[model samples]
Target: MEFVILTGLSGAGKTNALHAMEDSGYYCVDNLPPLLLETFYDLCDNSTDNRMKKVAVVADARSGEMFADIPEVISKLRLEGKQFKILFLDAKPNTLLVRFKGTRRKHPLIGEIASGSIEEAVELENELMNGVKAMADYVIDTTFMNPNELMERVTTLFSAGAHDTLLVTCVSFGYKYGLPPEADMVLDVRCLPNPFYIKELKPLTGLDEQVRNYICGFDVMGEFLDHLYAFIDYLISLYRNEGKSELVIGVGCTGGKHRSVTVARMLNTHLLENGQKSAIHHRDIWKA
Candidate 1:
């Protein structure tokens, strides 16, 4: 199992990093207490299922007094031969102050725990976390980074097979429901024949062999896919050269259940066949 502990300043975007890790297929837990670190690792380690192979937990100032135990726990794990990495996030004090002010959220060290201004709280937290920070395998200064950039950084550091390849996500959607906001490229498959009109195929999805056959039966379908595959192959090369870490391709038709799903699946297969890393998701498949 690959275990990762995420820690950092209160306003330094640790939550955003955790969300990014979750999106990258890691089983993530936020605000995990330091005392439970070994217990959590044991649970994940002894699991028969493979889903726990990658786990990330956030241990920050929110753990209060328990936060002090983090460094010791990390040392124990290391001594016991448990493999893990620490990711520490930090930002300039001014940037952290601005973030806290803009969000109007109280600093974790304020009130009864530590009586002072936000600046003092930030400084104190930094001092308390300095030990953990020194042990980090990766430290990200997020003062100038936006959420997207931070996510890319986190994914690049922790995602499997992400070192030398771009991650491609193919989304199947219905135009009527609106375009996916994150799409890098949108392909309209509405021009293809609609299987919803056919009484027999109406209830079936693109995954069904009959629906797949019907969609591929059209000459135009073959022609479109041929050109589409060639274009995407060229585009992927360009994107890789440009250092693009991720790409989202959207395929849309009247409804997401049929044509869009079929086309997205075809695109995903084509990408895999060409040695590209890709994932397919039918966004509106079960919508009424």
Candidate 2:
């Protein structure tokens, strides 16, 4: 079983994060009191057989003294051999103030936040939160990130592991013309002889076996596959460690329609097989 404790300043999107975690299959509890920490752990301990693997708890100053005892509670959980990590979210004061104003809600730290004046109470709360922040395993700045981006980051952390990297690949090429960009990696089967040159294959899609075999016949094809697989695996590990959000790998050949489509599909399959999250777009494959 794994646990994630989320704590942060008011209006930092803790609620949104909790929802995202729930969407990702985490058993989530919002605003749990610190005193119940022991009982909660015990309940989870006894329920490990029930397959409740991922649990998320939102703990913040709203719980009064429960917030103050957070450190000791965390220590106790650690001593009890529970697996857990802390995630802290922080947003700029101006952004937070604007959010509160837009929602017409008072700051949890300050009773009523004035439009232009910075709230001293909120500042004090932040000061008190320093201890928990210091203990955070992951701290996210929400000042510039949107909800979708934040969810992506959170999903990567859990699904991709602590060291997995996120790669965003944009593949583009013209159907009538040849390959597209200077891909960090390129696979050119243009010389494997275009099966498109054949009358039957010319009308058929790259999905046809004759076209696939024609392209794969080249020795370079097998070699490219071997090297590409190894390189991507290494990159997955590398990007995760570097906290990379995206990587783009373009596959192209003469005419994006057939060759590039087939290769991209193959590569996409391999990526999914390796347990990496990915998406594919035909780009110019269907352009007018």
Candidate 3:
């Protein structure tokens, strides 16, 4: 049986993640108590129904005092020879605050559990969840992700037979728009020639054939790409050996409209050709 423990902060989209898991054929239970986890696993493991083979449970801070028992429960499970993976969903405190304000939902720690403002509650929750986060097999930061993107991420990570290898995401962004906080590696491609200088290529993005051709036309681009590919190849092997489940590579140039997008696409192509699971996002492409 495959058991997945889904836990995270109050406004980190754990509910949406659970729904995504359910859609992906996982039998999901929400807000399950830590004390009952062992019994629940036994029921699923001993059940005659094959549909119960894949189980996902959401055990978050809402369970009050019972939540404190989760670490011990996990330890017991490990001792019993039951293997499970913990996926922790998280977002920046400001993002969580915005989501809470937008939805008008109360923070779980704002009531009898503790007394404070929303921001204070968020801070307290983070401190409380630190231990669980440290033990997480995967930590997903969803601060900048929309619902569809979050669903895609959850699907990619939980997809059958896809979790063995590390997933990579190459994001192209403008330096002016700030760096992607989730990036594990940031590569600056600003040293390359800027296509925005060319009158014809100025209006076209890296996705266009003309802009792509112009960007790759430089000899330095080729040499840089060769080294970048080799470095990424070496780095990913080390990350996989270190049990990293995902790697986010940020490729940034001046405006993200030209050079960075081009190199990001090149990296995406390299990963694809090597039979790796990767996704590319042009974060500031449409920004003026």
Please report the candidate that would top TM-score against the real structure. Answer: 3
The candidates, ranked best first by TM-score, are 3, 1, 2
Which stretches of candidate 1 lie above 4 Å from their native place? Answer: 112-115, 161-288
By lDDT, who's the top model here? 3
Candidate 3 lDDT tens digits, 172-281: 99999888877888999888888898898899898898998987888887898889999999999998889787788999999988888888999999998998888787
Tell how far residue 218 is off in model 1, in angstroms.
Answer: 56
Question: Global CA lDDT of candidate 1, please?
Answer: 0.84
If both were scored by TM-score, which would come out higher, candidate 1 or candidate 3? 3
TM-score of each: 0.56, 0.55, 0.88
CA lDDT of each prediction against the hidden true structure: 0.84, 0.68, 0.86
| TM-score for candidate 2 | 0.55
Q: Model 3: number of clashes?
A: 0
- Error of model 1, residue 234, in angstroms: 33
Candidate 1 per-residue lDDT over residues 12-62, each given as its tens digit: 899889999998888888889998999999999999878887889999999
The predicted structure with the larger lDDT, 2 or 3, is 3
Backbone atom clashes (below 3 Å) for every candidate? 0, 8, 0
